[model samples]
Target: MENFTEVLSKINTAKVIAPQIDYSDYVALDLSIDNEELAQSNLQNAKEYELYIQRFLDRNKAKIAFGGYLETRNLYQRSTVFKNLNSEERNIHIGLDLWINQTASIHAALDGTIHSFQNNTALGDYGPTIILAHHLEGFTFYSLYGHLSVDSITNKNVGDVIKQGQQIGNLGLPPINGDYAPHLHFQIILNIESNFGDYPGVCNAGKLDFYSNNCPNPNILLKIDNNT
Candidate 1:
């Protein structure tokens, strides 16, 4: 059997969000801690994030702003879910985020069965999330879709069949989407262990090594090429 990373690299996937939009229309957006622009701007709430993304899209002349796998960010400061005095601040993002203001459709990246679904109601959590288990080339792995609208998990069940490019849900609005701008937090897990609908999408530097291996860059599956 091939290694998980090799298997993922060999697989191809459809656009996991808003399939109608062309890949060429996808522009990269930087919300990382190193981004001077994000540091300079005061993005207070979900509504502000919406406006910020809109401006970014308009300025870039692109339909969507995407990126942020393994990128460190300061945006999580507002929520205790990411930080507390006792815990190492989880500031690094482990999943790729596809951003757009509208409630765009979310799709399955590959053929799989629903592994789990949940509405993590914490202030800065995944909100509505879904995990899919897939087998390819004799390797079993999982895919997670987060920041989805409430309706997404409304009637989902474990082990339900999901097809490649199938519409699974819609991008959630702010507050419902962990109070951030609308986006789909997509991740690939080589070993899900006992994690259900939720997994650590963000981690601190100390835990980066393990997470970097367990959760490979989603682009390996997205085939987005150098995190375009």
Candidate 2:
């Protein structure tokens, strides 16, 4: 069995990013569904409106890159807009988002092998997604890159070695990247539990505790604060 403490301690050596578009950018806004009280309101349209703003941000990502660990939008359970969404889509965002325009180069966070890759096609899905497996300090973990362009997985194969900072893939565009906006839904998993090319990015309020513990913050790996 893998010890969680040792895995977390090794995080200090893991490659990290600022979680922003670039170094000089400041936080613009944050949106998250963690707010229990506000979630009760008929905020379905409000969430949609936020997507529109996110689309606008996608259009101008080159100029206004996202940074820091942000709670970037609100999602409600009553709204079918997000209700009908798959397990991977429901329960609002469960990871940090690195907002940027299309085709930004995605670098691997560590030396790992391609565990799996797929083009998850759906209105609001990961489009072209990739998962990398890493073994460190006697523990195994996976990293997921969603909203990637199709070209990213064109010649990729399982078990292929991906060095740290290698260009894993390019960001996908609207209609292909889950219909939300152009950004990277970067998440880390302690145990994939057999899911491939896709994992739960959102979880219900009833199950937040389990998901939160299983999916530790990517910021631990990104370590953005030290970079500045």
* Number of the predicted model whose TM-score against the real structure is largest: 1
**What number of clashing residue pairs does each candidate have, in the order they appear?**
0, 10
lDDT of 2 at 209: 72
In candidate 1, what are the lDDT values of residues 1-228, reduced to their tens digit?
A: 678888778777888999888888889888987888877887878888888889999998988888899899988999899999899899999999989888799999999999999999899899999999998988788999999999999888999999999999988987888988888999998889999999999999999999999999998889765444
lDDT for each residue of candidate 2 in 1-228, tens digit (9 for 90 to 100) = 546644654564433232234544423334555545335443454345345545546555533334323343444344444466454335546666766443577778888999999988865567899999988877788889887888988998999999877778887776666655566788878878979889977665666777777877776676544543
Which stretches of model 2 miss by more than 4 angstroms? Answer: 1-22, 26-28, 33-82, 85-89
lDDT of 1: 0.90
Candidate of highest lDDT? 1
TM-score of model 1 vs. true structure: 0.96
Candidate 2's displacement at residue 11, Å, is: 4.1
